[model samples]
Target: MSQLTIVGLGPGPRQQLTAEADAILQSGQPLYLRTQVHPLTADLPAFTSFDSLYEESADFADVYNGIVTRVLATLADGPVVYAVPGHPMVGEQTVAKLIPQAKAAGHTVRVVPGVSALEALYASLAIDPSAGLLILDALTVTPETLQPTLPTIILQVYLPRIAADLKLTLLERYPDDHAVTMVQAAGDPDVERSETGPISQIDRLGWIDHLTSLYVPPTDETVEYEPDGESIDGMVRLVDTVAYLRSPEGCPWDQEQTHKSLTRYVLEEAYEVVTAIEGDSPDAIEDELGDLLLQVVLQSQIAKEAGEFDIDSVAARQAAKLIRRHPHVFGDQVADDSETVLVQWEEIKATERAAQARVLDGVALALPSLVRADKIQRRAARVGFDWPDVQGIWDKVAEEVTEVQAAITSGSKPAIQDELGDLLFAVVNVARYLNVEPEEALRQATMKFTERFHRMEAAAKAAGQDLSAITLAEWDRFWNAAKGR
Candidate 1:
């Protein structure tokens, strides 16, 4: 037979206590109360309480562990009734941890339910929880854990310090003047008292104890985690983490970084992501992508601090752009192929920016020269200033190369530099005509050259000759060997 019985004391009122709980307490067996702090305990039969654990322990975990240890030890002798305030399963940390371990160790455990703070809170606040309600334990609460759009009830506000901590956390999401209700001795009509004021004054409510609970009303906007228990892919959690990092209590280095300061990091992370993708390692790509996302979040956090924008605004803008651009996917538009999609996308962009003065007005100056040149030529093509075909582009490349050769023969440095730039631009046009991104093509070409160069170095080392000491002819021999390999 099971020797352990867990029961709730029903929010400290004799009338509110359940018949089963009362019968168990009066069964003439060894009864143990978690604490003697409740109002209903005075009218009950004499029993041992674990109130001393609270005074002697270092933390709540220690106190709860001590209670569990004592309960398990006493259960070895005979059957015992363990009573706690409110429902045994609701905000009862000791019971939550104890029951599972006890049952697994061959002890039979039974729980008798009683009135929880949810019921008491509803009666006191006069609100329906069905609309949207978030129940949380105050001890483990944070701004990220809070769903601000739902009416929230936080239980186990057992100390003034905990209340102050909760108030600070709430201030991160709620305005300082946001109203909150503090209910004490819930469900006990004689001792039940309620106070309403700004959340900032939570610590000053004068009477905070195990029975106290806080009720927070919904805000104007919805929370990231909806009240329906659905998770939105962790975007909200990431946003909240970035916000906390930019807060006054956040890291000093993170707080000092502005949008301009983070630009270099953004560029570096983007390059790393490209490298990772090219390496064909999925784990590396995922890690590099996370780093790139950090740069975006950091910039948004800085912008939010300046009162300019936030992650949500950035996401909303991109979402709207995607919906607008993909008319075939989101609207009644037909695009049978990738080429048609590109044409429609460009047309949509042109219509959106009809007031632009120049064709290249939207092209960023910070883009790589090759990519910027490609964009410029594409934009110019839309305005009727491009080659008619790939042959024309090839001819242009040949003409630019001739000009560069003539400039070099004449020994004019400036003319040579100008002609070389024109040659590179012509090559970019050729790449574009071949339906390849010039910058990406160049990057791949460079990586291939680097691999061949390293192979040549390794061949030189295997031949017991350093490349620096070898002649140009010997270098060519190793280079040719690496090429053939």
Candidate 2:
């Protein structure tokens, strides 16, 4: 039977290689090294290394495939030994692809383990991986892949450009000055080197190479899952609190509520958040946002109880959608400005929607009437269904007003209501054309009127008169005085 042996060269020096791995290397069978870049490769038996493939191939995938093809072809010559740095299973792409292909071809496979780079990294940095560790490949690192609160090690930062890109992605979740350690030739006594510095300066280092790996210690300032799972962070604790509140042993009101019963509170909490934002009160904004978040958590909990979906799945879906839509950030597509971003965003959303879905289909029906009107108008405008100019919208508003007046004069209640709605819709279009938010404009107008009415009531009270009993003329006088003030 054909045989293929895969061996690890340990992290560094031949001394670190396991006795079993040493025996396999000394078996004197045809030897192949994944790469000759490791420090101990020179001390090993004569072998062919794939170092040239790294320069010839366009990407790591291509190089890995090329290595696997060559290694499998060599099996026709009887037994073969393949060696890789660190460990055959850890961060070694070629070995992973080679094993299954060799096995399918009826070759017996043997894997000899060696000390992995992660083990070396742990020793050099004096960190314990049992606590919590996230290992990431530098080439595929992105903002979404990082968990700032966990101890992380990024491998294969072999080039300055990769390090630079990794630095930017890390900066999204970590402070620019967060301390990170870079270890090279980790377990080799003669060449091992470690440097500690701010993450922002990692790309500026002069000695990065194929053997380099970075270590980032855990931080508690950010909200993320605890490794032990015994304790919860603020957000997770809130989720637990909501779960408890809805449990049989909890609050009567919370336990009795269903998703449908809590719909109004969702809307109310959202409006309160908007009000707090408009009021420019940070504390109120924080409190109101917490209330709004409760609605989401509660809805997710209700769905979970019904065997639907939980909050984590909800967040995962949203994150996936965001990453998919944002090609400029997560992919290669370029968006130079916000307008370009919006166009790209809509294009991506259009692809996600069903072919028969209308342009306004995704707009929430539960939104305030004015806001809903604005959203509907904007959706139509995107597809060129809008009036050519503000003049046309204004003319339409005027026409609706005339029809409303005629309906009122004819004493037709339904006709009057229909025309009134048309007039309001036309007005909303006018606001859209002028780039104004109709809901916010109406809110401000209503607030202004409320303030003036309050002043009028105060004036009437000071004069010892009841506002309800005041004549129209007196009302106008007080109203005008309040408006003037």
Candidate 3:
């Protein structure tokens, strides 16, 4: 049976290399070095023979497999020493691959632990592994795959060839100028930890070697990789990110934006979110809802900067209002059905407002006229003042429509305005009798008319006729044809 001893060579100098590892390397057995780039490789004890098949293999796994093959073939009778950089248990990929392979070959594998890069990193960075530490390979994974619950150091830089990839992956979750360090040869006097510029400048094909690594200082960039099991709230992360974006050090444009400036965007994103939901695409809805949520956070961030409020206040206000309005949910009130729920909600809302002062205050002027009129009429009707039947409202609408026509024929703009207001008000009352939201109904109708009218315009344009040059009769034909009137 073959026996394999995996030895760690510390970070750099022979002084720091562990005694156990030193004893194994000095024994007269076949020796394998994962890499010769270590600063203290010159001082490691002379061996029976030396092999460096690990560093030469372009595919690292191929190198490990070859090593396993050679060791098993040689170990038919004897034992061997395989020396790896740093602690054998740390970010050493060869050791990770070697254990399973050796076991598969019926060979007993022993790991000789030595001072790892993390030991030097912790001392240099003033940290403890138990406090929060994540060791990763810089070549295989991105910073987006990192956990941020504690301090983290990515290892196995091997070469600057992977630096660019790491940098690009890191930039997604970090600011461009985030100060990360390039750690090389930790623990040894040659140990260097340079607080480098943004990750963008690190090169994958440059001077980086096996000893190279990076340190990302703690940030609120929403870490996706949770190495240690911990729950992260997405909403909190989003809120924090938004907070930073609106901060002075964040985006200048985002900082300058106002709630009003983002109004249309909020509306558009909200509608897009609803559309994505209706489309039954969870991924699309997630993306669109994220966009919609951005508006909320962005607005809150702006308000915070202006000393108005932040996301917490925004959430708390909404939550408190919800609790206050939802008596059926949290209070002793009871509502048997949807209609009763609606009635209770309105009653509670009106009562709350009445505690301050009450008038025809159910609707604000900012609402579109038709909608406002409808709500005002409804609120008033709840107090027992409304039309006895739908016909009364219909007659009022006809009378208003007639006055508007008569005023147009008489060519008086002021009279036209008065009659138009009356017609709109009457239509709103009629809409209430029909149990439709007048605002939504009018908006839908307006959109329908707009769609057909655009077709009429396009048709006229295609025929090379200016709208002003076209007579009412010609316009009527195009509009009728466009709408199938």
Candidate 4:
């Protein structure tokens, strides 16, 4: 295989260029300069007549791609000398592309390292990139894509025009007050470093070029998490966590759960946790919240096992729902008041449910019937299918009760059962109209009745007359006494 040499020209002149790099440059098989714009390139002791031609390219990608093409072409002839400004390993775009391509094409690629911008910048400032450093091409990266990094070296800040664009993009994700230091042609006789506050003002200093690089120190505090799982280095998707929980390698209990099994626990934990939040104990809520999240996590684990959905799907679907329903946040649809927000929400929810073949569906069937009924009734009431007020619902309930009583008097079981159900349904409407949860209200009523019945039993027991043996009149007296009737 033909040898493809990658040579670093250093940040400045031949004096700074390492001996190994000089040997590669003098090899004379064929010399290709990645770019001639660096001060070090112009400072080459002797002009290499066969340097790579890149200046005529319209863009950086074109120039780099062309360099790779030329490098491959040169390798077919024999050995080649490919030179780039700064270290061959540091932010040299052509080398980054060429090294892999040459070897992939069966050509042997050799890298000859020399002084990098990072080395010169570090020495000049007495700092170490080892503390934490990031490098990027000034022509490509936006401020938003940059991870908050320490001792960042932004290379290839070719011209004033590119620097200005980079500055604006930086402002979007970083504060205007972010400090940036510019190092130009470090180690050159005309070497310069400019320290500036405000990313906006840094562009005004415009002596930046292909030889220039910026050093930004570490940004903020880092929060660490449980590292017992997968690679602690990467940004773990929530789905990955769910996958672990569901996988054969994951938790045993979590793997055993199903949607049907988790339903009751989900409801119980959610209500108890919501109660903590409403009770105004943020501390209690925090613990209970973890419990609530366990339910969601466990459910997601089960879904993943079943090949249905996972945590990410659940979160993404809910996130999309909020954005879609609220349109005001993610879109241009205006909602000035709570009323308007609610109206938009209802309309959007209805549309979505209709798409799911259930326009009027408010709650899942898995919910208790009473709570589900209340939710359905409230949703319908918002659109005007409700009693005007509690008084109207009370009248409807009373009317149903009279029908029930009349049915009872007729001594017809089917009629009485039907009428009793209607009376209860009407009572539910009255409870809804009164702004009460019918289920909770009925629970309290039943508990009170049980207590009163126990009081009557106690009073009868104290009388020393067995209730079963007592005359009708005596039993009546004791029952009245017990109940204060």
Steric clash pairs (candidate 2): none
Sliding window of 10 residues with minimal summed lDDT for model 2: 223-232
For model 2, the stretches where C-alpha displacement exceeds 4 angstroms are: 1-231, 354-356
Best by TM-score: 1
Instruction: Give one digit per residue, the lDDT tens place, for model 3 in 1-485.
Output: 77898888888888888887887788878786766666766776664322465445533445666766666667776888888778888876667777887798788989888898888888877777786677777744544456654466888665544564466556555666766777776676765645566666766335576677787777776434442323335775575566556554688888667778898888789778866875799999989989998998888766554435556667768999999988988999998899998888888787787854556854666565776788888878877888888888888888888889999999998998888988888888888989998766765687789889989889999999998889989988998998994
Winner of 1 and 2 under lDDT: 2
Cα deviation of 161, candidate 2, in Å: 37
Where's the lowest-lDDT run of ten residues in candidate 4?
A: 230-239
Score candidate 1 by lDDT.
Answer: 0.84
Per-candidate local distance difference test: 0.84, 0.85, 0.73, 0.70
Q: Can you rank all candidates by lDDT, best first?
A: 2, 1, 3, 4
* Poorly placed runs, candidate 1 (over 4 Å): 1-233, 409-412
Say which prediction, candidate 3 or candidate 4, comes out ahead on lDDT. Answer: 3
TM-score of each: 0.55, 0.51, 0.46, 0.42
Best of the two (1, 3) by lDDT = 1
Clashing pairs in 1: none
What clash pairs does model 3 have? 158-209, 160-204, 161-204, 161-205, 163-204, 164-204
Better of 2 and 3 by TM-score: 2
Off by over 4 Å in 3: 1-232, 267-288, 446-485
Better of 2 and 4 by TM-score: 2
